[model samples]
Target: MPVPSISTKKLIPSIAGKLALAGGSLVFGSWVLSDIVHLPGGGAGLLALGAGVWWVTRPSKPASFSEPSSLPGWIRRCEAVLAQFSELELSLGLDGLRSSREQELDRLKALHEPLSVGVVVSEGGTHPTTSELQIALEGVHSLELCIAKPLPVVADAWSWPQELEELDVILYGLPMPLRAADLLRLEQLPTDRPAWLLIRDSVHQSREARQEALSCQLPKQWCDRLLFWSGESADLRQGLLPVRSHFVQPSRSREITKQRLLTSLHRRWQAELEQLRRERFRSLLQRSQWIVAGVVIASPVPSVDLLAVAVVNGLMVKDMAQIWGCSWSSEVLQVVARQLGTAALGQGVVEWSGQALLGMAKLDGGTWLAAGLIQGLSAAYLTRVVGASMADWMALNAGVAEPDLEDLKRQAPLLVAKAAERERLDLPGFADQAKEWLKSQRYAGA
Candidate 1:
């Protein structure tokens, strides 16, 4: 044989390996001998020796490949590739989105033009007063002020032509308190323009007088557009500038009042939007609570009801986030819901109310349907309390980070107690509403 190759397995053993092999053979032989001889102390000695040998000679674990210490190199590489692919896809999508947004912004810019304003003078006031307002407004060339006659007559006198439809704003000069008839006339006017209530009264008027002037109820739709201005503080000299120069002049002092008025209008619009959001939030929350209550009523399990409440509340938070124009993550809402649910449970309101309702129903010889109605109403009440608290929190911190859950938890019990008191007063009405809702559902299902 041409120089036989020596196998690695047949190579001479290291010191440690030799020791391990020798120890294993000796211990194994001793154990067998002790078993055959039945020696009293030898058996224990042999068992201990065998354990030592097994520990020493257990086939060197071969650097276990299955330990899960790290993912395979190929798997890591594949993951990196997938991540890059996802990033590439997102980048492409974002590019298209950015392009579309730029185009939309350009379109909006192209449509932007100067506002055309109309001034309406109250006949109850003198023509000199109308001339004074017209003279003051003459400074603003960017605005075309169409002077119309007083309240009741102005509705018929002012014509709304295709050109007039472009009127961006209206200023009403009211010297006296508005009557209901004046309000009706106002309602009849074109709604395309935002309206301002220019009170000709001096700002130095007594608090009582000012209060009396503003006491009249404006229509809900008009309240946002109807701003108040007083001529008491305006400089007489500053009021008579040419309308053409006013638009071009970059004088800060001249623009101050106009800027202030614009700022006030913006704030009013924001408030209106906020109010609408809250109303929508409340309605959605109530409907969600009702549905969740119905589901809980139908279900036999109590644990499932808790889960349902959490899920429903989480969804409500998402809706609220959209309403408030804030970013939301499901995780944050879940945390909030959990905290709220814990608070509700800790206060024992839900438990006590449910048990009390069930007891009353049982006393009245009630069926499952009666029990469900009680449970559903209780659920709706709890939801209302939670929703109210959430709305308050969102209103206070719109466009901010997610609310502090701990704060919500602390406030929830107190809110629930107050809600309970309110519900007690409104219970009769609520009962009738609930009854109608159930009937409608039954009819729909049928």
Candidate 2:
């Protein structure tokens, strides 16, 4: 039988940390207010306490996954698969998928191609690898797994991948595991399995190892089938899909809730925002972009980079930029060069560049990079742009009037700054020429 997994549970600490920080901030604020007027008990103790709480709950790792021992064997099997690798690589397969799963499947699909990579597990029993195959097909990935009659799942930890042919699992109440240890021991096991072992985890090896053990026990028939492509050949591509139990998204409710929450939150935040310094805001956005871009390039964590940039830059996380750029009008200008002549992303994407500067002057400061270059950007691109163009597009898409772009001008300092800044991007342009063009534009802005 196939195994089951769970949603990543290690990330809980991050949420707790945020809550702790908020609680600390409240206490710190009260302490500050009291101290100002020489309250009888005002002191730094409360501030320290608050800081401690923030320190504790701030998310340090992904959520933890703790399984109940009494849960069904299938569920336990799933957890073992996921704990094998980073959540990004382990795909939660079918036989356990819920409704409206396509949205999630697509997101995973967008991240990586499957045919180019494969995971094959030829269990020695009658387990329907096909069922698992269907689940994985959602992402256009394939795996090679061996299967046979059913059997009891053991908690054994010593079952190495090479000797799993002796495992106790029976696909259909069969007599014993179709042992493949001989093939493995002789080193005669075809080199092309491209498969990961799905088994129980102990102190040393993971559940993937267990699965590997099971594979080693396969019957000659199935074993021989794999032997054809077992040789190390470039044409036979295989990869491991560490299985896991994770919830897919693009959920309508999640979308609505996130949108509404951000809208209200940003709106309430604007009161304080009105007093916020432009340069300070610019610095924050720049820092945010660097961090996010760094993550996008450096890690497979997710799309948090673009979203994080939006949050720090005071832009609406979900709203169309053309409609919401007004909210950020004072700090940035966003231009979105769509892939198609229209917004439809059919063929692929082209390129886009954004420049940030001050009145007719190109500005550069510590860690403040004001320009960005984007190549082959996708729908994900629209996500990072901010300013008038964003607001225009959002408003246009939302069926609202294009807010006044009337009387806007290239402020000489900002224009000059933006122009000179252009040279800093990954493009072929001289700073002087870009500067001259920006300076000459009439300062007719919304």
Candidate 3:
């Protein structure tokens, strides 16, 4: 007999699943021993077996260490964050971010009504092939095709031609024997829309020469988009199959093209917006870190530690979620804060900060003011790390309809580590900012 296989995307095995299985096995084994075999101490034996099974199958606690901001350490911290936060809370937080991000993405998609495509020839390239491609593309419904004469190849500051701006896609023609100027022109092209490079191989080259041309090291973005052209209509159509996939359809021609174009535009817009969002996230993180540091400086006792940080971070989380277009709810937000707080504690972030502050006091002649500065700085650093890791988490899981918190938890350590490593690179700048902040505080006090 042949065994049948089932495919599933749920690759990660959960503790809950293991526990359920163990419990069922225990129940069955107990019944067999106590009822059928008349075995002794069935209840006690069953309890022991259950305990053993749990001991073997239980999720391991996040590892701890005192390594100074290593990549692995950062990852461990991130994992601890996942373990610390409530699964439901983390899911909700990510879901909230995705909702807002997707909405903005959809809105941008709606605005992408690409009615035309532009064909621009490289400088010194012949116009015959450009005209031929234009004629061939005319049969493509709902896409206006326009041909442009060879433009200036070399410019220090390159900008897209005004005529090309309204076009949905660009089919750029390059002359045979590719020149450095042609590559430079390609490098200057806008990334907003798809740009296909049609290298007109008018004179047939040796197989080795053609291979070398195809293998010519262009940036990865332009690698697959460029191809050799024999100027044949069939070759042009076949080469453009992927681009045509965006809008070409026989049925409901107009509506299908628009809808497909919108979908394609949405993906591109999402990538562009993600870059913008990261910049905004960095600003938010910096502001939030300072807010945390300020709270630490103001508080005479540690009683205000978690509460003040929590309130500040809660608002930060809400802002981040909104930036990502995720829905916001206070209950889930609080849960996220609480869990991450627990992780920070479990991972010795609080202890590390306290020791650092004491060391600062020793170096600064034990002044209370100096101690406060160190404490605040340490708090600020912690905030920056946590906030950065959260941003990473949100980015990684953004479009997921139902985020698997357990899987995220398992990945936390690595994410936290990566964030820590990145933040570590900015340590000099971070320190300079802290010094400036300390000076301002001192001047204010004076």
Give the local distance difference test score of model 3.
0.60
Superior by TM-score: candidate 1 or candidate 2: 1
Please list the residue runs of candidate 2 whose C-alpha ends up more than 4 Å from where it truly belongs after superposition: 1-320, 323-423, 430-446
> How would you encode candidate 3's per-residue C-alpha lDDT over 160-266 as one tens digit per residue?
67656546667777675667777777777656466777766667576457645566666557766765556687776666666566556533333433344444444
Q: Count clashes in each candidate, considering only residues at least 3 apart in sequence or on different chains.
A: 1, 83, 16
Ranking by lDDT: 3, 1, 2
**Which sections of candidate 3 miss by over 4 Å?**
1-117, 129-145, 151-171, 179-291, 294-315, 318-325, 328-331, 338-369, 395-403, 443-446
Model 3 residue 192 CA deviation (Å) reads 12
Q: State which candidate, 1 or 3, has the greater lDDT.
A: 3
Error of 2 at 296 (Å): 37
In the range 1-446, model 1's lDDT, one tens digit per residue, is 01111123333368899889867876776766667776667756766877897798654321111212222332333333333334323533323423443343333223335545566654575222545555666556555456664544445443433343334555565555565545655665645344555544456776455655465476556554433344432442242233233345434323332333333333443454455565567678767767766766676343433745574666687877666655757787666666656665566656665664454443233232465556665676566556655565555445455555544554555554554555557655555556566666667768
Clashes of 2: 83
| lDDT of residue 375 for candidate 1 | 65
How displaced is residue 323 in candidate 3, in Å? 4.9
